[model samples]
Target: MMNIVQMGLGPIGQQLTRYLAEREGISIVGGIDPDPNKIGNDLGEHAGLQKIGVEIAPDLDSVALLDKADVAVITTLSSLKKVSPQIIEAAGHGLDIVSTCEELSHPWQTQPEVAKRIDEHCRKQAVSCLGTGVNPGFLMDYLPSVLTSVCQKIDKVKVERIQDAEPRRKPFRDKIGIGLTEAEFKAKRDSIRHVGVEESVRMIADAMNWQLSDVEETLELVKADRDLKNDRIDVDKGQVSGVKQVGRGYRDGKEVITLVFKAAAGVTHSHDTINISGTPTFTSTIDGGINGDIATSAITVNAICSVREAGAGLKTMLDIQVPAYFDEASP
Candidate 1:
């Protein structure tokens, strides 16, 4: 069985642990979380499951089972700088890592120095490390890149995601500024930067080996046309419902890649669309949109075997083979 250590017992982390527990050849050896309330609690209980005997440790150093772990699934903060220490500690103990940190998904474009340091450290430790999730890691980047494999020649690519935030978690709704006024939204927008569009754009450009002259990103408020009420919050008409974020990549005076994310509380339809203006001009749309929280946890859990198979180095979604559902009955 694959001995796994779970880091961060937040919503996504809890979901990931639950999924991992259901897999046949997997064992939850330990858990790491700094939350005092969660410390000493059974990981299964934190995940709303029957106690599985693994307790949450306040820190990685305190986990006696660290040396026995084959992999560490980290679902902590998004910043590479903040999450670097946790990743380093895991890799130091000779454990492969699969994390849901968005920026770490493709840090080469925005944080080359930090990426190099982490890559070198992981390589020295002889453990593979990957950062991934549903948006930056898949729908906006990896999935779009996979679609382009059929094209003989590619000119431009555009991906658009429209999501209704009403059904999402409170953190997600808050992150998108669901119920803020126009002035309030602008104030928090700079602080709460949208995590993944730029990374997705860079990942696409790097995959195609296109030399982008510039990558531009812009965020604007999505106002509510009428009053809106959701489980979390309410918004008056003309107030901020959410946001529209766009990232564009240009190469030699031409825009080659474009990604647009529109998420709000009252959106009529929630879907993902990809348009490739290349040979055969392909366009595809996903009917309902991928659920960010659930899909993120599923992808992180599904990536475990892939990370183990890809030995000893810093890995990305593009570096390893595509992942699939972990069949509990598989031999």
Candidate 2:
């Protein structure tokens, strides 16, 4: 059985733990969380499951059973700088790692030096590390890049994801400013940076060997034109509902790749659409959209198998073999 350690017990982390508990050939060896309230709690209980005998530790070093772990799945935060220490600690312990850090998804574009360092460290440790999730790791970049493989000639790539925040988790709604005034939204907007669209853009551009002359990003407020009420929160008319952000990559002064993301409480359309203008132009749409939280956890867990099989170094979605559902029943 493959033993795994879960780092961070937030909503996403808890979800991943629960999912891993139900899977075969995988054992939850330990859990790491600094939250005092969560410390000492059974990992299964924290995930809303019956006790699985693993308690959450305040830190990796505190987990006496961590030696059994083959990999660490981290979902703590999005910042690469903030999460580097956790990653380094896990790597130091000689465990492979798969993190949901957005910036690390394709850090080479923005933090090349840090990426290089992490790659070197992981290489020396003889372990592999990867940063992946739904948007940056899959839909916007990986999925579109996969689609282009069949194209005889590729010119432009466009990906749009529209999400309705009404059914999303409270953290997601709050992050998108679902129920704030225009001024309140503006005030908190800077704190809510759209994590990985630019990374996704660059990933695609780099995959196609397109030298981007410029990359641009724009954010706009999605105001509530009418009153809206959801399970989590309420929004009065004229209040800020969410945001629509666009990121573009240009080559030779022409936009070669464009990514559009819109998330709000009352969005009528909810789907992921990709348009590729190539030799044989084609478009693909996933109806009802991909659930962000669920998909993030799914991809992270699925990546564990890939990371274990990959070579020792800092890896990305592009580097590892395509991930698929791991079936225990398979020979």
Work out the TM-score per prediction.
0.97, 0.97
Instruction: Please give, for residues 239-282, the per-residue lDDT of candidate 1 as tens digits.
Output: 98888999999998798999999989888999999999999698
Q: Model 2, residue 85: displacement in angstroms?
A: 0.9
Clashing pairs in 2: none
Deviation in Å, model 2, residue 58 alpha carbon: 0.4
Model 1 alpha-carbon drift over 4 Å, by segment? 329-331
| lDDT of the candidates, in the order given | 0.88, 0.89
lDDT of 2 by residue, 142-207 (tens): 999999999999999999999887887777778778778888877887866468888899889878
What would the TM-score be for candidate 2 when compared with the true structure? 0.97
Best by lDDT: 2
Candidates' RMSD to native? 1.4, 1.4
